[model samples]
Target: MGTTPQAGGTVAEPITLSTGETVSVPLSTEATVYGAIFSADRPAVDDLLPRGLEPIRATPRRAAVTVLAVEYHRIGDEVMTPYDEFSVMFPAVEAGERSWPFASLATHGASGYVWYLPVTTEPAKALGVDVWGYPKEVAEIDHDDHVAGRRTTVTADGQEVITLDVEAPPAVDQRQEGVSYTVKDGTLLREQLTLDGRLGAWPYSGQATWELGDHPRADRLRDLDLGERALARLRFDGEFVIGAGEPVGTV
Candidate 1:
């Protein structure tokens, strides 16, 4: 069997998925990301997590809510169509553990529970749900970049779900690793992601703006009681690699 070479000088063996599609392991992508981190009510955040997880409070009463829009320019070494994706995640930890505040954002061992994930392509949505157990749906995700900044909008069923506007800031070279927790068939799935790129971060200061529409998904986020302004806004342009997810425990 021929081996497929990947980034980092490693070779990935091809495997056929349950969907009858064949792809290389450890998916890689080149994307431009726009993100905003908001502070939400801790109890409200916890209400949305699975049984085995608890919200990671950024403060005694506040939890972190993250919204990200990724514009994928390439996937793996094969020629594929580009797609846009938007996600909502909450910083969380396994139950029965001491929850760390803001430190959870940068520290290892913490996981982000994906609450809503929408992609523009069927293949992307199918792969995410079938492999990683990500809560993915096919939606209209539009990513627009301009000389000034970027704007991303997500719509479903002819109704707008959410829209985020981010201002461009100067970036610095950085690398980050993150873990994500998802649920499939009542089992908790853990996936690791590594990113290498130039990161641009800005403190809230009323610089970032987001609006929720009448869609039910938007209403769910509205119920979270997120802070009036974002805690931080970020932009990253670089390489992203997602490892296969494995079952960690029952959800």
Candidate 2:
């Protein structure tokens, strides 16, 4: 393991990856996220990726799409205050693990890649873009919790990017957890997350729509040629937390 200089002359813990590589990462931020997931066939979108970042197929070419709204309660950066994030992601696992989604129902440790990450503050954008290499930008985001579940929207310069509505039904106590992947410092990193609250979530078929706006980055969704029909929709109105990302390996 290698060390990265931390604040106050202390060294941050070096994370070990499955391939025996190591890297230092930001470990201070802890958040509770409220989110939903949808899936669809996005062939055009799959072509733009580099090696080892291919979409995990649910069917032949259908991929999972996740829409998330996050709340950061504990963090090291206060300037990124009012820490809220609106994220869209897909499961892009190892090249050979293209069948990852098949095991999603049986395992919770699968990882994916972030398709789009837009936060509410400038400092947050800096960390996301500069440090994490995520395509995060500053945008106007709003949240509403109603009887159905949660509704989240993203807008910039008065133009809407996307809108999400989900429902968390009543049921027995339950929990769902998973990990998302990111490439940081030339090493693959896995972000651990868990959702615990309302267990009975309504599963609906084909529910997400994307209005890719004029924002250069936001509008990139056009390349995906995403079909009008979503694959599935999952509702979650529970407590979710993300742990410090762990190093896994290179792509």
Candidate 3:
């Protein structure tokens, strides 16, 4: 593993494993999360994946575009400073059933294939990509909580990639669970993430928009022809946990 140098004083207090190996994780935390999950479907672009790894679709022409802004209030076992993270992912399954994406709208169904994940901290970026194969990169991500809602932007090398605007009204108490997939060492990894908190259904009320910028990453999404109306909008304010991921197969 490469050395993940923590930005001065931002290093959380060390956590020792059973074998005396210290792990990087929070003991507990409170973070505000806001995002949207739109849809995209271009036959030419959608057909790019292998049949075995079928993309999860809303309709024949609609694939999920998920954008997020997560603010870790104080990650250090409460010792390190705080940082915000932004990510863009396509909710995909292993290419099997049509009932999967709907499960997220109803219950915990299938997971997603995260194509791009970017974080504000350099150490987290290194760990996310080098350790977990999470297609991670270091970028400038910011989140501002306003009376209307949360505004988020992700930029790389000073170029804005995408921006999201979602009006957050009073949240409705909710509990949510979902799975995500990633590959490492030729093995399929499934990560189940859960959030037990409050939600504001901004998309249902027509209060959201996704603006893809001119950056390459943004252009990648543009190729998919994401719809103007998000198929799903995720506005969560509560406890978020990425469960211990286990290897599912050597695909």
| lDDT ranking from best candidate downward | 1, 3, 2
User: Regarding lDDT, does 2 or 3 come out ahead?
Assistant: 3
What digit string (tens of lDDT, one per residue) describes model 2 on residues 69-94? Answer: 66666444232354678777776665
Q: Candidates' TM-scores?
A: 0.91, 0.69, 0.78
The lDDT per prediction is 0.81, 0.58, 0.63
Give lDDT: candidate 3, residue 203: 39
User: lDDT score, residue 112, model 1?
Assistant: 86
- Backbone N/Cα/C clashes per model: 0, 0, 1
What is the overall TM-score of model 1 with all chains considered together?
0.91
Query: Residue-wise lDDT of candidate 3 within 187-226, one digit each (tens)?
Result: 6677666666786654344667877787898887888887
TM-score for candidate 3 = 0.78
Question: 1-251, model 1: which lDDT tens digit per residue?
Answer: 58777767667657655555566657888889888788888888888998888888776778888888889988776534678899899888778877676666546322489999999977777678877789999999887877768889999999999999888777998988887889998998777788889878776637678899999999989999878787778788999888777787886
- The residue ranges of model 1 lying beyond 4 angstroms of the native Cα positions read 1-5, 8-13, 17-20, 106-111
lDDT of 1 at 190: 75
Off by over 4 Å in 3: 1-29, 42-52, 98-111, 202-205
